[model samples]
Target: MNVKSGSAFFLKVIAILIGIAVLAVCIYWLPAAARRDAIERPGDYSLYPLLVCAYGVCITFSVVLYQVFKLLTNIEKNNAFSELSLHSLKLIKKCAFAVIFFILLAIVYLKVLTQFTGDDPAGPISLGLMGILATSVVAAFMDVLQKPLKNVLDEQLKND
Candidate 1:
């Protein structure tokens, strides 16, 4: 009924979806036509590496969502939004740094794409994008959580 409850439910649903996707890729899709094609093709044979990276990314994304949902529920219970907000801010900062670092690395990889001369460079690019996107989502969630804490802090200061 409340915002926190709704957010928690949404996060659980997302986790489920991510789990399903990972399973589909690992159990169903990868062992079928895609794997066959990758083997038959005369490329870099990076299918296994790509699949592993993708699985890791999906897992990490789901875990982050779960953590944020848990944080929200805890915030609601303890009325300690200020402390959690600060923690979220720290997480946001770290995520931002990670995004920036990945972006730079991806750019360098792209610049040197020609040197690879093995197969398509899309795998690394896609992985980098996924990382950037995941960090962006977490950072945005932190920003959303920060608003209420900011309001509470401001109201407390005004009362004082």
Candidate 2:
């Protein structure tokens, strides 16, 4: 394989590894982490659901990464401007939006928890906000990237 193909292969490997790691974290580490948190703050199981939500978000992220890997594969096969690639980008954008939406929901949940329970939710709230910002940026970038590629695909289709 040429350098470009090698790079794409490497990226695909990395994406697969990331997805595996995320799955491990969600399956093994998350419940443990939540249990630890609960043990540390006895009687406060409120964070449990949030932890589950975080796992859900991680799963979404993993799906998006898989989509990215598929996109890269399409590129390697010289199908970068095809409808499949366009659909992959569209799916990625939607996943990013889902991430943003879920993070925002978590932030609101945290805020409400603080209001009712008087627990200091500052740390988790801030983290959720950061997640929102990061996912928002990803969504925006995907949106920007998709538009031109979509137009190019449209032109290609018309020409064909």
Q: How accurate is candidate 1 locally (lDDT)?
A: 0.62
Clashing pairs in 2: none
Compared with the true structure, model 1 gives a TM-score of 0.51
Best by TM-score: 2
Off-target runs (Cα >4 Å) in candidate 1 are: 1-7, 22-34, 41-56, 75-85, 92-107, 116-160
Q: Which regions of candidate 2 fall more than 4 Å away from where they truly are?
A: 37-44
The per-residue C-alpha lDDT of model 2 at residue 41 equals 96
RMSD of 1: 5.4
Worst 10 residues of 1 by lDDT: 46-55
TM-score of 2: 0.90
* TM-score, one value per model: 0.51, 0.90
**lDDT (10s digit) by residue, model 1, range 1-160:** 7887676667767756776776676678756856686779857554554454445544444455455555656655755656665665556555455554646555455646546765566776676777677667767766876777778878888898
**lDDT of candidate 2?**
0.87
